[model samples]
Target: MDFKLSEEQQMLQDTAARLVRDAYGFEQRESYRRTKLGYGADFWAQLGELGLTGVPLPEAYGGFGGSGVDSMLVMTELGRGLCLEPYLQSVVYAGGLLAQLGDDAQKDRLLPAVASAQLQLAVAFEEPQSHYHLNDVQTRAEAVNGGWRLSGRKVAVIGGHSAGLVLVSARVSGGERDEDGIGLFLVDPQQAGVRRRVYPTVDGFKGCELFLDGAFVDAGSVLGEPGKAFAALRYQQGRAIAAQCAEAVGAMEATCDLTLDYLKTRKQFGVAIGSFQVLQHRMVDMRSELDQATSMAMLAACAADQPDSDERSRTLAAAKFIVTRAGRYIAEQSIQLHGGIGLTDEYAGSHYAKHLVMISHQFGDDDHHLQAYSRLMEVC
Candidate 1:
């Protein structure tokens, strides 16, 4: 298999890197973080103009007709910039689901809006009771005369505060955790019986807790098949995992570069700390981990497109698990190498470090993926 990126892919990567470097300075990022939106609105619009908003969608829908590799490249730059935009929520989670399962009408209506950045979306899937359980939906979607009435509470709806649309998961029948009988519906947060309490995460992102008490939706509101969305949901989640791993790799890369800069500039005992053999060795280890994470990210990008479900799961789990390990090592090492100021808000290391922490816990932690990898090994 050809491992190098195509020329088009290289241009995409370079464009992403340049945008992040030029538009996202540390002070400007702080200004954006202090806003109520918890991210930069204008910067998000700029991403749309640059065609990044539709990296993974089809060209017919105003996208660039790209795939996992393309999306991975953009996500790495986002990570390096420590971006707080809702790309993961709008593009990867909501758009991926709609593309994979939405009818032609649904795709035509929503995907174009998404690609043009006219509609912002947040996915409501996590519950207080279901920890990282993608199919463990407890929200009920009972049949009404002409549609369905949803009733359940979802906690920590990422990017909900600024979303123009929300896609929800609800159980139509079967048990709470059953993969079958699960359904996804498009709902407006302003609709009747929908209550939201928005808040900011420690990593400087906006999220919300949604209480849906009999929110009504027409039969047409269902995005995919009536009672069969689990497979599509899983597939979207695998893609998300791959994209996120790439982002973590980017953060690790930035931290490694930042730490090296610090070592070269920060002097101790009238000499550059970087000249010390022990310090140089430590930086080498950090760089090595960053390289490993990058390789794993490529593996994940490829795995997301695999035809076999088992292969996708195994490879994604392995990639996520490795990212978790490598990201933590890089973040911790960065802070230690930079001294007390590494975690201070004035410096960039703290922000990257915090983002890495958040990424580690997202979807699943190291332990979660480690167990999955072991189980896959047993099956093999």
Candidate 2:
């Protein structure tokens, strides 16, 4: 397969990169970090106006009708710039799920708003003790007069506090943690008995913990077939992981860029530090690591569009595994090369380091992906 980007894709990358560098620089991010929202509403609206919030969605849904690869490009740039917006959680994760599983009525009512960024959505799937297992949901949804009532707690629901709606996954039949009995419901955040507590993350975004006493929704709110939402969730999860890997690749690239600039400026023994053979070798190694991570991210993005689930999982796990390891190494080397000042908040090097660390642990970390890859390999 051709790895080169088309003209359109290149333009998308350039637009996102420029927007991050010019409109929402590090200073803006710092200000946002101090805010209660942990992100600026204006910044998100600007991204929506630029069509970034809808790139990978369908044109019918108010999107630009781009592909997964295009979405990955935008995500990478966001990572490189250390953006505070939850574009991935709202657009790629929740929007993709709605598009794939929502019925015509559900899609017509919800997806257009999501694509236009008028209504932000988040997936409330993770439980307190589920670890990374998608099927291990204790949240329960039971049949009612005309709909379902959700009752349970969801921990670490990214962007849930600010979300207009939530795509909730719960056990509809059989026991909790059953793979075939899972269901998804579209719930309004303003509904009765719903409570959220928000917390800031190291990367400047916000996540939430939800306590649902009895959240109710119409039966039509069901996204797909009853007891079969796991397939859709898995598909969305793969896409999310792919986007995150792309982001990690972007952070790795930024780390290399920052380190190179540092090496050229700082002097030692009346000469530029970059002239030293030791630092030069380190720069060379960083370049190699970044290149490998980028290649793996590209491969994973391609695989996310494949029809086979098993193939997608294996490819994404491999990408996540490679990118996280490389990202961790690059982040460490960047700080080490820059010395003590690198840890200061004013330094660009520190931002890259923090973002890289966050990305390395998101979705699934190195160990999680390694185990997944090992399991897939055994079955294959």
**Most TM-score-accurate candidate:** 1
Model 2 over residues 1-380: C-alpha lDDT tens digits? 67888998999999998888888777888887788777778888888889899897889978988877998999998888788787989999999899999888888888878777788999998888887788998998889999989999998788887899888898998776789999998888888978888897775678998888888889898989978999889888888988988888877887798889989999989998999999999989999989899889999888887775677889999998999999989999999999998898788788788888887777878999899999999988
Q: Give the Cα lDDT of each candidate.
A: 0.89, 0.87
TM-score for each predicted model, relative to the true structure: 0.97, 0.96
Candidate 1 lDDT over residue span 1-380, tens digit each: 78888999999999999999999998989999999989999999988888899998888889987888998999999999989899988998799898888888889899998987878999898899888888889999999899999999998888988888788999998998899999999989999999999998877778999999999999878988877988877788888899999999888988988999899999999999999999899999998888888889998998886774677799999999999999999989899898899989788898889889988998889998988889888887
> For candidate 1, what is the lDDT?
0.89
Give me the candidate number with maximum lDDT.
1
RMSD of each: 1.2, 1.4
Model 1 spans > 4 angstroms off = none
lDDT of 1 at 145: 99
